[model samples]
Target: MGKSGQFIKRWKSLSYDGKVIFLKSAVCLLLIKTGLTLLPFLQFRRLFHRITETSTVKEVSPQQIELTVWAVDTAANLLPFELLCLPRALAAKYLLRKVPSLTLEIGIEVNPAKHFEAHAWVENNGTVIMGKWPESVSYHRLWAWK
Candidate 1:
């Protein structure tokens, strides 16, 4: 079958909960992508903080965390525009807002070309749930939010 058929088949194969998570992730990613384009960094940070604050703290299972990561990554892949690591990480944070142990970290590194690069990732209980890079260890963590 063609790509569209494959996509439809994949969509049909997902469980109801999986489908919900995927849809939520897609919308969250799209919003974050657009927000990043229109808002200043500080203003967006405040908006994100307000959004996350609405969720009551609750203990989250590892399976739930994994599902959140999978949904965000899959949705990011299917999106028409490319999503950078920050937006993906932010989307994961939004999905995992109820987890008190959730942490969002920003890191920086100097590339071989002497260009400074930044990366963002979400971690739960010290384990990275999104934005894991091949040279993840090389990036110096600049900030972390819990």
Candidate 2:
């Protein structure tokens, strides 16, 4: 069977709640991508903050949160445009329960030739929830936000 057929089959195998979560992830990814593309940096950040703030956070297991994050990350990666770490992290934060202590972190590294480089990632209880945390070790942490 073709990839599209396989995808449909796989999608059909998920439970109703899983499907809903996946759909939400896809929509959030599209919105984040579009907002980043069309709005100024501060405006996009404000909009993103408002959306996340307004989402209803429910009680969910750690494993369920992990699954949601993985699904959202996968969907975000498949988008046509470059989806950066901040949006992906925000999407995970939006889907997770409000009490898990997840943090969005930004780091920077000074390169002798290239001036500097920056990276963003999310962490939960010191464990990396998303982005390249292992690779981020070379970067000096600049700031973090809840």
Clashing residue pairs in candidate 2 (N, C-alpha, C atoms within 3 angstroms): none
- Model 2, range 1-146, lDDT digits (tens) per residue? 97557657768888888888888888887877788789998998787777666444456777777768867876776667777787787777767637447777888865566667787788887788788655534767788766
TM-score for each candidate, following the candidate numbering: 0.87, 0.78
Give lDDT for model 1: 0.87
Q: What is model 1's C-alpha RMSD?
A: 2.4
Task: In angstroms, give how far residue 5 of model 1 lies from its true place.
Answer: 7.5
lDDT of 1 by residue, 1-146 (tens): 97558667877988898789889999999999999999999999999988888547788778778878988987898899999899999999998889888899998875576588899999877877798877534778999976
After the best TM-score superposition of candidate 2, give how far the Cα of residue 20 lies from its true spot, in angstroms. 1.2
The per-residue C-alpha lDDT of model 1 at residue 140 equals 82
The residue pairs found clashing in candidate 1 are: none
